[model samples]
Target: MAADIRQLLLAAFEVEHHEHIAAIRGALGSATPDWNDVFRRAHSLKGAARAVDLPAVEAVAHRLETLFERVRNGASALDRDGANAVHLALDRIESYVAGLKDGAGPDMPGDALAALGRYLGLHGLAPEASAPPAASRAPVAAPVAAAPAPKAPPEPAESGAAILRVPGEAVEALARASHDLASTLAAQAPAAEGLARLARLARDLRAGAEVLAAGAETERPELRAFAARLGSFAREAAELSRRQGAATSAIEAAAVRVHAGAERLALVPAETVLGPLARSIRETAREQGREVDLDLQGLDLPVERGTLQALKDPLLHALRNALSHGWQQPELRRAAGKPEALGLGLEVAVRGSRLQVTVSDDGPGPDLTRIEAAARARGLLAPEGPADSETLLRLVFEPGFSTAEAVDTLSGRGYGLSVAADAARQLLGSVRLEPREPAGTALVFSLPLSAARRSLLLVEAGGRTYALPGGVVERLLRLERAGLPLAMGRTILRHGAGDAATSHPVTDLAEILGPVSAAPDPGNPGGAPPDPGILTAVLLRAGGGRLALAVDRLHDVRSLLVLPAPSFGSDPGLVAGTAVLPGDVPVLVLDPEGLAARAAVTSAVVSAGTMAQAPRSTTASRATARATILVVDDSITTRTLEKGILEAAGYRVVVCVDGQDALDRLRAEIEPVDLVLADVEMPRLDGFGLLKALRADGRFARLPTILMTSRGDAEDVARGLDLGADAYLTKQKFDQRQLLDTIGQLL
Candidate 1:
């Protein structure tokens, strides 16, 4: 009976989880919520808890429901007290659910039970009301508040969005199971069967990731990629098992690592708390005569457990402080050479391995005079000591310290800065205060890429095989392990096979996947750490660009359909699909074209201003003397816009309809084209195939070419550049100036 009850309780948790999310959404609807909607949700939660025999959960929910019922019927109005009651009840329910998971047997705290009883008394409901009769409510879908509210209402479930929010507790449990699987797999010896099993698990894990991102926007490409990854990994695992021996160990390891990453990718939206935070901030700010403009960047950011929870209060408090104290009166601000209405800006960006959040305001910054006086009075500084701006600013974070003349009713309690500091520290993050370039101050908080796997090779580093597409690979080469040259700025390995000699770059092992173990063989000699010359290099086409990735082993190449990468911005990772090789181990197919586009956006060696900038030398004057460089992009607007830039800078620019037409023009043209600027991600014959076709033919092999597209990553760029591409550029990072500069350099 006890076991049955526990199982039922878990089921109830899954049911009520939807209600918790719905209740919050109902309260904060775009329009002032009709009180009945709020009451109905709370009432439903109470009845569900009661049916599950979780009396504590039922009792608290019951009291809160009645409290809202009173407000709905005009017996009591929505007030701060009512809101607090609701907040406490919700917090308690969450805590109880967490406890149940921790073996606390669905028990609620005594103080919380007492508090709920008090709340019921305030609502005039009998404390002993015999546990309100069970009320059945069909599962209310998890609220999709991120979607735009309709004018009236859409026909049921017709909302275009597809993501559904699952309870966090359930997700955490799944995550734990995934971790256990990883540990179990890691403990086994590296074998074909083991690698194959691990690869199938990776596919399943990717399916779980899709469920995680489910009910989010259907337009999110990553979700679809996740679904595709699962199928690919499953197939790949089967293939890995078919192969035998130690030579296949790396492939097996790669599959396992990829599955591990897919599990982490099953992350929920961390900014879920922001919806509540915004409401609280709005209400609190109204009490103080301040008008705040709230701006949030990266709302789609996915975060794991601790990092998401840790950010809740600190970010909220910082915004509240900005509203209550940071801004001056509109007229005063206008007179003092600032905008009348102050702006509160919150920006979140992922820079490499860090999540950077900057919150800033344009207000009287610290009132330097007051800070100096406070420092003097507190003996924090010598009477005539060196109290610089930075030194004085440091005092704000001190406990029980503030520059405000007197404690304010809303703020100036001196705990805001300390609270913010503590919250950042708890997340393995840091916070800083520095004056924005000109006026006011900016609070920048940095959080690490908590879910990112740490390793040298992204492919093999995590002991997993990522799928690489057939179309992306130009050729695979085995290098001599010894006597590699470090000239030409890249790791170049030289080898002699009969009369033929080959030289290759020793790229960062981590850049390709991670640090890889040596491929055992006597035919290859050994070199330095980065210059493990005997490694296999796969030249790939990413985002219609090029890259040459060095891998420790070369497994069989098979087709794995496209999967979306776990993306932060426009730049996805080096993956496109997941395929099973001969061993049934899953290998993530790298999209060299997509990767190249991303790399083109991020490559520091290529200037952002230069990649998209127009060329200065024109072919009109030297039409007979020089070869024309054609720029082919899909958008007529982009083509027209680019033509103007190229024309202005004196280049003979021929605008082609698409890659296919460009190829046709190249083949049948009378004049020799000096270079080609083509978009990679276009319909028909993409830039990658065009490059390959051109390289395969003798006519265009030596023709300088620059591939332009939106997809960019180091591997993609390397693949393109390695395949004889003169330049690889992404439209996202390269402006007209950058494009022109790249063209000039290539020319």
Candidate 2:
């Protein structure tokens, strides 16, 4: 527990240090530095470092604090040398903090102290008597050369009451539990109100009895006594009603507070991650011999811990890529009539239900010629035709598809962009590459802002409740059945007029993922008359694609705590997660990308115009043009079974033992394989390895690969897709007809 506390404190210190550095840099750039702000930050850092038992960091922070204080008191003037010294001190502090994170001891090194003393001496501030002499100090302008700090004596562990550090997941779980309880309590509100009403009714009954008794008092003296008793009963009932109402209100308010507090606990400002990210960019740019400037916006936005955690590495990789591949050398940039220092801009905004993060670089945009050449060499593009810009740009995300000529510490192995894309997809988000006009490239990542608290539009489809992210829904349309248009073998809805108008492809939500309902069909009437009833369609936008989902009914929008669905039988692609409703009812949170992909598939199937056609045969004349399939499996039975199916369908096939063997064959074969069918569990390597390897090789980065496994779990499927698989099929659900159809679609 003490160790955990130290870790938490270290993380906090790291964030604070980065923030202070950014502030100091900004302040130094001005006509005058904010001495007070600098001093306060340094003091805070010292306190935090001491709390975490990081003596090295604490010592350096103390020196910085004293220097800043002297400047604040007008005893010393801030100058260029002084500013550089402060920056150098900050760098030392950051390095020690980083070491702490890596499990290093927290004692300040002798050389680091010597360097600090030198910088202080330059500003006419002498070091303490115990400190090393200035004659042994390193240059103030040079980077700090310090050995590891000496280990400090262990202190007595504090009681849990003094400081408690909780894991982020635990906090999230508690928050979710609180939300669920609150929702349950809210659902009982009507019953609570009903109880109050019952009390009111009892009072009314007593009052009625009193009135009856009062009227009869003239006939009988006994009626007068009964009337008084009835009045007393009425007073008691009214009092009970008032007390119950107050109690209910108090309970409801408490629930609300608990839920609110839990939510706040689960969120941290996005700036917490930005500081380190910006620092990393600067460091990487320096290492790469490139001069780049970073501009950041929307750092103050709140982001869930989980989202921020998942984004850190991907963002880092992107920054590295921007510095390494996107920006040219300063001399080259100047020669190209560009600024000596390239500009990398990062902007974060909450768009709808998604957090949109854009990273753009002011450098030469993607080289389509080189991309096309690589794609053709790998058989990804036809040799005879020019590939479109969008298609060429997408190649950058393909594993092992770098345009760089040689491998380097930064990017040459070709996994950087792919990793970024994978991380986005894992979050049920998307990463897109857009070429900037004139010059440069922009990478945009759109992710769900928070899994815990999402504004979901509850919609009923095929008698099942599904939650669609409210942010993705552009607008709701209610149109008569007859108003639907049939185009390209799918139903479409056209909205607006003239240039302002748009047409959206529509599909039934029930038919996409749920059991089919015997509902009236307007798009396909089967020669029957179309229903004249109004139909509701939800228009959704996912990345560059748009689709309208038709549901049986639209329910109320709700803010729900989405929980990950169990791996069993769920499709991560379609089912984003699950959320519990007020009544303990669970609803699937639909992924917009999955829905869009399904819609596209449906449209393509219809447009193919091959529903009634027979399979084409491979004649001698067509043999050379026939598509090739690579069947990889450890089991001979599986391989033979799959090969026979493909060959019988008029395709050539090659068999491999496992992922490793398949990769070797792919690399050695002169002819490119059209697709790979590999099993998940195999010797040497598995299906995921095969997929990743194929993607990592520039030659086959875009090759279609399908994972066939008996595991049939959501995690397995998700993993395969995350590694760049085209499709995932379970053995139990596999059939010759389905396999052929899937293969045809992919090809």
Candidate 3:
């Protein structure tokens, strides 16, 4: 009896083990796996194995737990070999548990233990070479197969989106709720129609009374008064009927929105759809004897599942292209002063309701000269015509365009980027490649956002109502024309008195949105005339400046879903996208960035006359064309502070995590940097070593280098100077002005 009970417990653990293993495998496939969850799964499996008195399973589970714990603590990483070993262990445990039904089945193999041992050895955390001896013997029982997978919802064709499965019911509740709401709204139509009938009846009664009053030849005051009262009752009843109809229409619109919201609720996060892609590509890289660390960002943003599914293939192609065309040999990477492993990144972000996805890598950026030659050879570019960067870059998307000397596994067919471009077009989006900062190439995709909620300030511009992002609005004000005085043919709103007060130029909404023929105007045709005395203006925070935008009327702020811009008309820069209001009304959502840019342009125009007052000379123009500075520091705070100061002082700045990164940037000539500001102590390479290398090289022998550190010792300062640093600055006695002056002198 005890033996039978033990067998039943073991069988129960088998099901639980399968589930935990599956979940862990899924997590490992993601670009950004939740290590905590992975650890928990492994830990639970170990406990389950121990409860069933399976020593071999328990031993292996404990090792997995150890391995996962190390990963969660960031003490070690799971490379290709480590991942393989984990799978091997899981497989061994599964087979061992499956055979437990047959008494005295077979000896458990030691291969899983040995494999895990080897993997953990890489990080100096190797476990025992063998599992517990008792698990070598398998108990006898009936054959037990794994449970069947539950039915899931419709999923992407690629395995990436199916990393996590959801029960069918997980999707039905919201749809059912939306359907119920729509049904409820439909019931209100009868009441609205009844109200309409009542209004019509009242109107007929009033007409009959009016006819009676007119037919009365004698001067009868009572009859006329009765007719007037009937007319008043008809008007009030009609108003009530109109309001009821509007209310019904509003309810119907709400139903539409409820349905849309429910559908959007089923939208899957980009991470879920793109998660398994990392492991798939990583395995491919391993097969090619190359390695990459892919970082995915903004993948948590939820979007329509179909949209995410559509992106999977193009994004995969882009990543494969990065690996193929941008492959740098280990020796070449070391020579270029970079890490042997490539750092790849895929970032998805929203730009004014437009989905922007980028795939980038830290490798040699595009060789423009080679690209131009390739284009010319392919006859895509005229031999005698100028080959500018833009024109040359565009050729990469050509169907048969390729810069490779020979076809290889990585890139030679030239259809990869072309495929991405075609996919973007099919989705009403666009794709482009640009050289990334500090080296490498980026393929950027700009597509339509299926649905996103945003807080919007709806205002009427040129007779049409549009939405402005509420975050960018400073304040909405109503002022008399006397408050806004004209200055050089421009209206200005001044705040405060004297020097403390600042003035901002004002522009009409009609001017920003162009012509709207429907605008009601007395002074001008096809235009809106500004109010003669009173003005409704929105004080907006725009592009490092302020702009008071004048409008005819201001509407309430609302949170609504923003869709991609409509394709029917020419899309203006100011129109970010569109949002649906009640009654199926579409309102244009304006881009804040575009509004700010326009405000800046208006300000420049308003200040055009002042240009002569302070004339710009050649020297001033040179000064404004900021000199580039490279700041190297391990502390992010220090790097950010220095960058901000330099930028504010009219100098362009680039930052690196440490001395080695700065050296790589310099060696690659990512940018023509005029000065190097480095910390004395940093990981990978210290300030002294960097200065020594720079002095040894003839190219950077006279490069202006500064050593800034908290080490204020005289010996440290002397040592930095001796190593060819132009200046040594101590953080203990730092002064911003003095630092700037020193850099100016060095330059």
Backbone collisions counted per model: 92, 2, 7
lDDT of 1: 0.56
Tell me the tens digit of each residue's lDDT in model 2 across 79-196: 6456545654665565555445344644444454565567667667777632312344322222246554323222211222213556776765665566455445534544655666
Off by over 4 Å in 2: 1-19, 25-36, 43-55, 58-88, 98-176, 217-219, 268-276, 289-291, 296-300, 332-339, 345-347, 437-439, 450-747
lDDT of 3 by residue, 1-747 (tens): 988787667556755876787678777668898999999998899888877777667777877888898899999988867876786567556556545543232445665666677777778874553233344554422112322221221222222233245553554465555555543443454466577778889889888888888898987788788888888888998999988877766765565566565555566678657754554566567558786766778877776676677788888888988887778998999898987778788888877547898999988999899999988887888888787898888889999788888898777888888989988887667899999878899999998663445556777767667777654565555655653444223555654333245555567876866742221322233555546666777776665556678887666666677777776563456776788887677777777667767655554443211001122354554564488889999999999999989888888999999888888889998788888899989999988888878877778888888888887553464356446566667776677975776666566
Score every model by TM-score: 0.42, 0.53, 0.46
Candidate 3 lowest-lDDT run of ten: 606-615
State the TM-score for model 3.
0.46
RMSD per candidate (Å) reads 19.4, 27.6, 22.0
- Model 1, 1-747: lDDT tens digits are 787666656555644644563555447332477778777877777777765656666666766676667778888665544444455456446545544542344334444445445656666765555233444532221211222211211111101221244565554455444434433333343343456658768877877877767767656677778778777877777666655434334544454455454444454454444434544554455446455545556655665545656777787777767766677887888887775657677776765445687778877665677878877887888888677888877777766667766777667787887888887766656787777656677888876544222111123322334444332344444444432333223544333332243333345434544332212222222422333435556555444334556655443332232223334322234443333334444444444544554434434344322222223465433442244778888889878988788777777778887888888989997567877888887788788888878887788877777887776654565455555565666777657766665566556
If ranked by TM-score, best first, what sequence of candidates would result?
Answer: 2, 3, 1
CA lDDT, every model vs. true structure: 0.56, 0.67, 0.70
The alpha-carbon lDDT assigned to residue 570 of candidate 2 equals: 67
Worst 10 residues of 1 by lDDT: 150-159
Candidate 2's C-alpha lDDT? 0.67
- Indicate whether candidate 1 or candidate 3 has the larger lDDT: 3
Residue 211, candidate 3: Cα error in Å is: 38
